[model samples]
Target: MALLYNHLRDARIEWNRHQPQGGETEDEAEARAAAYNEKRRLKTVQSSRKSNKLNMRKKVAQKMVKLCFAKKDEEGVAAWTWFLKLLTELGNAGMSSEESEVGDMPTNSGALASVVVFAIRRCPWRLAMVNKYMEQIDEAALVVLTSGHSKHARVRTEQESEKFPPSGLPRAMYNPAWLTVQKTFLPDIEEILNFSEGSFTMMEVEVVIPGVN
Candidate 1:
């Protein structure tokens, strides 16, 4: 959330700096000012939407974590299955957005990835339990990779391709390697487990552990 705030702040500052200054004709200055304001407005709307989506994901992830600690045996597995279904729903919501056409991939991808990793990390048994959801995971991963939002997509895909070499799934959808790379850059599952309320700010997390990004 802090990262989003900082990004929005930086964007506003950049736009303000680019605002028309002295020596420009009234018409030129007016047009430039209008453009700046419009762009800024659009960016604010985008940021707000992204923030809301992320908050929803965080809430869902927190619930899943709680279930992991609270439930046991068949009951635990059943609860996890339900929560995983919720994640699938969330991911589908993200994918259905028209914004993806404009370079705005689903903000929930990271959250979905995080929750899945958290489950696997905390409970090795979840690996087998989640095997049924592999298709959904692969789909979400494809969205992330093709959206061009992942910094390590190319390199990660290349590495995974050499190992598994892409059979039924796209090379980039290899869940283990994809999750590993996301975990490398994203906030730690332990930190997320500690979250009681409110959003987890990527900037704040990165600050606590310098050089992770």
Candidate 2:
């Protein structure tokens, strides 16, 4: 994950002032051309690295959920705790408190929602011990967190196409596992479900209309 951040931040340091200018000597123009090409190359690299970072987050979330399914309780808690720490560091480094008001970067709300969903479903008892830190989540993130509990709950992915497909999503309602999870978590799945009256209209659009992003 740190490696992914390193690749994302690489763009910030490699910026060079190399735009073509009028009345330049042949040698200077050649140097500028090379630098400009390097700039384009760096842009492509940064784009690929950004995709890698988002993909890594999905994989990490999936792995943590998988560990919970395997009933590796202790390992699940440890992995979840570590992942939360990583996200905190990433958010702070990318958008510090003082600068976030002026920044355009998206919040980690979706990622937090997905991670919390799996934690509530797979390891509520274990989560209770470590989730005190969740109180620090900002109001914007909290909104998205509760949004998933709504009936119109939509599963949004960071990538339209991923190399690794998701598996073992949380159980649907009325299933034994679903009931168990609902019983353990607060707010009653029933009350949360009552909050939303509409269904997710975009759920099947990906398959119905490919390349629509």
Candidate 3:
């Protein structure tokens, strides 16, 4: 919502700035734009409210709901609301290690991975979600933060070769795995990791370890 409102406000200011100060019918054009904006804004809110109801429903496999846009309407507002709503739910749910998410899959940069861990390895990732991980997680009481949000998240290994350009993505997993995505309120986020320009790769995450050290 904040993102959406900011964009709308910016667009309006730019529109007004272009008007002829004393030109004939200047006020009328401004009024028309304002009215049109209001209607669209209202619609955007309505869509968000509808999605909120859907978000509250608890489903293991169906965590996030995807929103669509009309051909001519701006999509930022709807996207903003959808993300904010996801964040609200995410903060409350303890993150799981067996899940993960990747943004715009076949895309580059600006991609984000939200790692939810109950324990911060003062060391490196153990390469697997162990039973020990589960135990620590339950006692750890975790919270996730992201520029974007989602429901189910998973862990993945990306081991890439230097010759290939992607050095972190694993060439292959010995164990049969359901590659997962580390989700955030918005998969679209700041370049938290310079992992890869496109394709998949391993990204680092900082977790607050559980218990009094």
Candidate 4:
């Protein structure tokens, strides 16, 4: 994943270097950058298809969640919550009611499932609040985490004959395996949850400004 990220970063830098910069106005520079970024996005999509790499945004989001959870602080919780909401909103966008059914398989469901699994694995203490937020979005986040593997299996079976499947498998499908691995070092979820609870506190304060009250 690091190799893939470095490759994409280098590609973007090369694109920027080749962009016309001779007496260009701010608007022109912005437009050129936007166009270059779109081209880079398409290149990334093609590269991912060819190499079976996960999308950079999703990979980074997952890593960010891991890092935030590792901190186990109030600020980390806030950041994780924000990212979870963003992922859920992104997954829910353009989804149909029927497609959102419990048994129905949606192409974008992986994003939400990934968020749920991360919460389960890293922030189980906040699972209740996570579920409440998911309800606001009309998603059964826990259900998705529990049942996503079967859905992914079905999709894989349906596309068994294809050279490349249309959608990548949900990261949630590997949660069980991850849990098994985690047990070697962190064997007690309850202990982790208790430790997290003791690690962070939220407080409110008033700020005074020099120019304004």
Worst 10 residues of 3 by lDDT: 59-68
For candidate 3, the TM-score is 0.21
lDDT of 2 by residue, 1-213 (tens): 999999867665444334335867767867986877787976565455434433444344444445454675665445544544434333311211110012133345733232211011122221222222222222113232333222222222222221111222212211344345655774465544332242311111101111221
Task: Give the per-residue lDDT of model 4 (tens digit) for 85-124.
Answer: 4444323211111111133323465533321111111222
Task: Write down the lDDT of every candidate, Cα atoms only.
Answer: 0.37, 0.35, 0.33, 0.37
Q: Between 3 and 4, whose TM-score is larger?
A: 3
TM-score for each prediction?
0.28, 0.28, 0.21, 0.19
| Angstrom error at residue 13, model 2 | 24
What shift in Å separates residue 210 of candidate 2 from its native position after superposition? Answer: 38
* Stretches of model 3 off by over 4 angstroms after superposition: 1-13, 17-24, 59-213
Q: Write the per-residue lDDT of candidate 3 for residues 167-211, one digit (tens) a residue.
A: 232322111132223224325322332223433222222222313
Q: State the displacement of the C-alpha of residue 138, model 1, in Å, after optimal TM-score superposition.
A: 13
Candidate 4: misplaced stretches above 4 Å?
1-20, 53-213
Give the lowest summed-lDDT range of ten residues in model 4: 154-163
Candidates sorted on TM-score, descending: 2, 1, 3, 4
